[model samples]
Target: MLCSDLVAHYGLKKSRRVSIQESLGIFLLYLAYGCGNRLVQEFFNHYGEIIHRHFHKVLDVVVNLSKDIIKPNANFNETIPEHILNNPRYYPYFKDCIGAIDRTHVKAYVPQRYQIKYIGRKNYVTQNIMVACDFNMCFTFAWAGWEGSAHDTKIFNEARRRREVKCPLPADGKFYLVDAEYPNKKGYLAPYRGSNIRYHIPDFRRGQTRAVREPKGFKK
Candidate 1:
């Protein structure tokens, strides 16, 4: 039941080499166990003859199919839920916030020569992945393939270079929420620095609390 729904949602079709169900099954198994080829084959109670090769083949097919549709290269826009729109308690920034951005590394074993360049300073051989998530926490953008040594700020700059987010920052001051690894650049906001603590509100308040907090230099 769920498999059919997923296939329809993902718009996957029967490949020339395999059935849609089989491909879906391989993907599910990968997500379930995060196992290597041999381990995945063992989990499926099969030898290397069939399922192992098919798993990778299915992955390649799906990745190619999904490449264009996965990430939308548009600037952030407000698509606030009906309930949240009417609630004064919620921060108005929720509507203006384009997305939350972060980077992570996926560990892998590669050749020594490759690992020399790929392994990060922390000594973990990893592939760096950066992603941007909308207000709903769904990924709207992702970039993978950089080495783990790549910094999150560098990844963001590169993402900008790709011309994906071409829209200008909002005139009324829209911004992005990013981690400490990112700089407090224009069009993006990070936590207030210790040196600049006097300028920012320690905690944003709502409703009557806003009135009490407003006079103390927390006004938006």
Candidate 2:
């Protein structure tokens, strides 16, 4: 099963040949347990001896076969969150906003040289990962492994430059919701400017504050 499908997908080298049963067994074992190479080796010790190197080869075959499994489609399916779609109140400023953008970091074993440039002001070294999560809090896209020193705004701009998320907008106008880090643009709606803008301030309610409050018992 493994050999036949892999050969059909990637076309095996003319010289090297592996039996279908052998490759299929290894792949099935990996899929069944989802264990690392060492664990797989120990588990199947009674059947036969399997090393990390051989296990990695089987993994490569599976990776290569993925292209065939996930064949090309005309329309890409984007998974957005429920809150973004259901609760427009939380995101009143961006009614159509379906995702949130943020950057995170991860540790690396062998960081690239000139690593000082990648270290943030906090002093800990790591990679910056930019993610756009749907309203459901599911990750729709992940942009990671960037130098930590890079700015999230710059990364967001780059993502826009690449035209990654191309959602359709309304006929009248379109806008995005972002934090203070990103600059406001025609299609981008950031929080109000300065401390005087009470709507975005802590403990401030929308359409209700010292400046914008209605008269006593006044009904809108």
Candidate 3:
């Protein structure tokens, strides 16, 4: 469905110069493995000139279609699902929790003048992307294009102010879960701070024999 929409939007038509399938193949290969222009041309067994032209054309199409492709789930309503509500570990305490929000860094290429701004503490150029996922482990919201050096709180504030990402507004005492990096605001909930405090599930499950044992209340 998405491919068809992009093809139609771009007015792409098959011809001896380059078929739509070949164009899509080249685009997917370039993105999937982050191959350089020369490597991609070699893989397709095409001359530098031909591959270079087609690669940029396909990239332009994909970039233009991203607004439609990378959007929030329409069904999201800031309500916790039954599966999460029924789980002993999450229920009661997190009954009002609907989803989790966090940021991840993806390597990026930038001009020399701006490289320092994009270089993070890890000493690499990257883009800090924020994502929010629901209980089903599906992404509900995403905001990309932030500089790697930008703090998580800065990105969240900018996203909220500009509404670049459609994070559902929490109501009826519901809120999205966030890490300590984010503030404990009306729409976001954060764990308590302090040393020796383990609020995450993995923290409690680590090196514990009970985590490997079946629950005593288990039933077929």
Q: Pick the candidate with the highest TM-score.
A: 3
Q: Itemize residue pairs with steric clashes in candidate 3.
A: none
Which one wins on lDDT? 3
Ranking by lDDT: 3, 1, 2
The C-alpha stretches of model 3 lying farther than 4 A from their native spots are 9-17, 44-57, 60-73, 164-167, 199-220
TM-score of predicted structure 3: 0.75
Q: What is the TM-score of each candidate against the true structure?
A: 0.60, 0.49, 0.75
Off by over 4 Å in 1: 1-20, 42-53, 64-76, 79-95, 163-173, 195-220
Per-residue lDDT for 115-169 in model 2, tens only?
8867875476777766654455555556665777888778777766765333222
Give the Å shift of residue 24 in candidate 2: 13
Collision count for each candidate, in order? 0, 2, 0
lDDT of 2: 0.55
lDDT per residue as tens, model 3, 105-208:
99998888988988887689999988887877877677777889999999888777874355455666878888777777887987655334655577677842
User: Tens digits of per-residue lDDT for model 1 on 162-189?
Assistant: 7643323333456677766776777788
